[model samples]
Target: MLSNTTPSGRDVLLPMFFIGLMFFILGFVTWLNGSLIPFLKIVCELSNFQALWVAFAFYIAYTVMALPSAAILARTGYKRGMTIALGVMAMGALLFIPAARTGLYPIFLIALFTLASGMTLMQTAINPYIVCIGPRESAALRISIMGLFNKGAGIVVPLVFTALILSGMEHVSEASLGALDAAAREAMRNDLSQRLVFPYAVMAGALLLFMGLIHVSSLREPVLDAADAPADAAPRQGLLQHPQLVLGAITLFGYVGVEVIAGDTIALYGHQLGVAHYGVLTSYTMGFMVLGYALGVLLIPRWLSQRAALAWSAGSGLLFALGVALGSSGESTWSQALLGWAGVPAVPDTVLCLALLGLSNALVWPAVWPLALEGLGKHTAAGSALLIMAISGGALLPMLYGHLADVSGPQRAYWVLLPWYALILFYALAGSRLRRWSVA
Candidate 1:
C-alpha cells in the first residue's frame, strides 16, 4: 500500500522547478500591491477607502476571468495557456507606463485588472497542475514549497517598489503634503506618479522574456490518470453534489479576504500610525508568511496532517486578529519576539499583530486546495476555476474594510477580520468533511 501511494522521487523534479519559477514571479507581481496600497495612495491622492480599490481591481479579475481562463485552457492546453497569460500580463505591465505618466487612478486600475486577468488564467492552469503532479499524501507539502515562491514576494517586492519608486520622492509623508499648496501638491503627485514608469517598463520586459522562455521551455502538462482520481465522485457530472467544492469555495472566500486584509493593509495600517517608512511594512507580514510556509514545507504529512495544519492556522489567525484589534499602541519591545534581530522595523504592537496574520494565513491556502480538489478527477479543471473565482474575496472584503476604516479608525477596522477567521476555523474542523447538505 505504501509503495502504491508514493511516487518515484524523480517524477516531480522537473515540474517543480518551472512551476516554482512561475509561482515566484507571480508572487513578485501580486504582493507589490501591499507597497502600492500606500504608494498609490500618495501618488493618486486617494482616500483610504478609494485607495483599496487597488486590491479590488487586481483580485476581482480572478473572479471575473476565471471561467474564461478554464475554457481557454481546455482549448489551448496548459502550456499554451500559460504563455498566452504571460503575454497578456506583459501588455498590462506596459499600460502602467501611460497610466503613470498621466497620473490617472482609473488607468492604474485598468492596468491592475488587465494584469490580474492574466494571472487568473495562470492560476487556473498551475494550481491543479501542481496538486496532480505529486503523490496525494505529499501534495500539501509540494504546494507549501510552491507557496514559498509566492510568499517570497514579502522580501523582494518592497525593496523593488520602495527603492525604485519611493527613492525618487524628496519627502513622502502626509505632513509634508499638508504643507504644500494646491499647485505644489498636483506637481508633486505628477512627479511621484511618473516615477512608476521605469519600474513598470522593466516588469513588462521581464514578463515578455519569461513568456518567450515558457513558449520554448520543457514544462510538460501533467497527466491525470486513474491512480490520481478520487473514488468519491463521478467525473463528468455537474459539481452540484460536491459539498466539498462549494464549502471549499466559501472557505477560500473568507481565507483570501483575511489574507489580503493582512498582507495589503499592513502598510496602510503603519501609515495611519505615522510609522517611518511605512511602505515597507508589508514585507514583515510576507516574512512571517514565508516562515509559515517553511514550516508547512517541513512538517506537512511527515510531522503534521493537512487537517491539523489548517486547524492551527485558523486558530492562530483568531489570536492574531485579536491582537491587531486590542493590542498596545505603544513601543517596540514585543517586535523582537517575532523576528527582531533580523532588523525588521519596530512597529506598534497592534501592527505587529497584523503582520503575524501572515503566519496564520500561510498554511490555509496550502491545506485547503488538496482538501477541496480531492477526487475532482475530470472536474479538476472546473474545480480549480471555482477556487480561483473565490479569489474575489480579496477584491470585495478589503473595500468594505476600507470603508469601515473611513468611518471608524484603521485600528477599529481590523475587527472585520475576526469573523472571517472564525468561518475558516469552522471549515478546518468540520466543514471540509460534509458530503451532503442533508444529515445522514
Candidate 2:
C-alpha cells in the first residue's frame, strides 16, 4: 500500500538536503557517547559496567518513547514533529549545564535520556519521510546518501571532542587516581566534569537554532497517490503477523548492538591494550564507516541489490571477527600487520577489528530499513516505530560487553560480536523475505 508516486527531481533534492542535515545532527549528538564513555568513567569514577550506563540511559529512551513518538508524528506531521524534536533536544542539551555543575553521574544519565527522547521523535518522522520521497527500489541508495552525512559527523565529532576534553588523559588511571590525595582527586573530578559544559552549551544553542530553521522551512509532507491505496478492505492483522518486519526488527537489534560495541567500546579496549592515542583511534572506526557509506552510495541498487549489500556486509563482519579472535591468540600475522598499518601500532589486534567492524556495519541500517518496511502501506509508521525501538539493542548489548570486559579481558570480550554478526547474516540470506502477512 506504499505510494508508488515518484517525486520530481527538485522535490527530492531540496528535502534530501535538509533531511541530510538532520541526519548529520543526529550522528554528531549520538556518536559523542564514544568519547563520553571513557570521559565519564574517569569523571564519575565508575566500573566498566557502571560507565556503560551512558549508552543504557541514552538508547533506552528510544525503546520507551518510540511508539509515543510515532503517535506524535501522526498528529503533527514531519515538519512540525521535527521542530518539536529539535526543541526537546535543545532542552536536553541545557540539562548538561546542571549535570556538569553538580557532577552527578545519575543527572548526566538523565540528560542523555532526555536528549535521546528528542532524537527518537526526529527519527520516527524522518525515516519514513525519506522512504516515501523516492522510488522504493532505490530507497537504500537514498538512505546510504544520508548515511554519508551521518557518518561524516560521526567521524568529526569524536575527533573534535577528544581534542577538546580527552587530551593529556593518557596519564590518568584508576591506580594513579588512587595514589592522589582526596583534594587532588576532587580537583581532577571537577576539572573533568567542567570540560563537558562548554561543548554541550554550544550543542544546545545550535539545536535551538535548528529548531527555528525547521519551523520556517518549506518541506512538504509525502503525498500518497490514490492508486497506491490498499485494494482490499479485509481486516488487517496485527504487526506481529508480518514475519519480515519481526525478523527485520531483530536484525536491526543485532546490527545496532555490534555497531555500538565497535564504536563506543573501542576506546576503552584500546586504552586497556596500552594504546596512548585511543581517543583519536575511535575516529578511525567512524572513518571506516564513512568509507563504507560512500561505497554503499555508489554500489547499492545500481550495481548490487540491498539484499546483496547486506550479505556482503555480514560476511565481511564475520571475517573481521575471525581475524580479531585469531590475532588475539597471536595466530594471524596479517591481522597484526593490518593493525600496525592502521597507525595504532601499539593497540591490540582486537582494537583493529573493532575499527574494521564499522565497515561491515555501515550499510546495514540503510539496507535493513527499506527491506523491513517494503509493503507496510498505512502500517509504515507503526513498523518504523518498531524498528526504531529495536535500537535499544544499543542500550543493552554494550553494557553486556562492558560486564564481560570486567569479568574476562577486553580482547576476549569481542567474542560477543561474532554471534551478533552471524544472526545478521541469517537475516540477509533469508529472514528479510519471510513475509507471511499480506500487504492488502
User: How do all models score by TM-score?
Assistant: 0.95, 0.93
- Model 1 lDDT at residue 340: 77
- What's the lDDT for candidate 1? 0.86
lDDT comparing candidate 2 with the true structure: 0.85
In model 1, the runs with Cα more than 4 Å from the true position are 1-8, 168-170, 226-237
Give one digit per residue, the lDDT tens place, for model 1 in 1-440: 11244556665777688888889988999999998988888777788999999999999999999888988887788889999999999999999999999999999999999999999999988888788776767889989999999999666898778788777453576668878999998888888888889889999999999999998988775555754432223343466577788889999998999999999999888887877777788888898999999999989999999989999999999999999998887776778675678766678899889989999999999999999887666676788888999999999999999999999989899999999888888888988887777876
- TM-score for candidate 1, please give it: 0.95
Instruction: Show where candidate 2 strays beyond 4 Å.
Output: 1-5, 225-237, 329-346, 437-440
Compared with the true structure, model 2 gives a TM-score of: 0.93
Task: For model 2, state the Cα shift of residue 47 in Å.
Answer: 1.0
Best by lDDT: 1
Cα-based lDDT for every prediction: 0.86, 0.85
**Each candidate: how many clashes?**
0, 0
Query: Per-residue CA lDDT of candidate 2, range 98-205, in tens?
Result: 999889999999999999999999998888778777788888899999999998998899889888988778798767887899999989888878988999999999
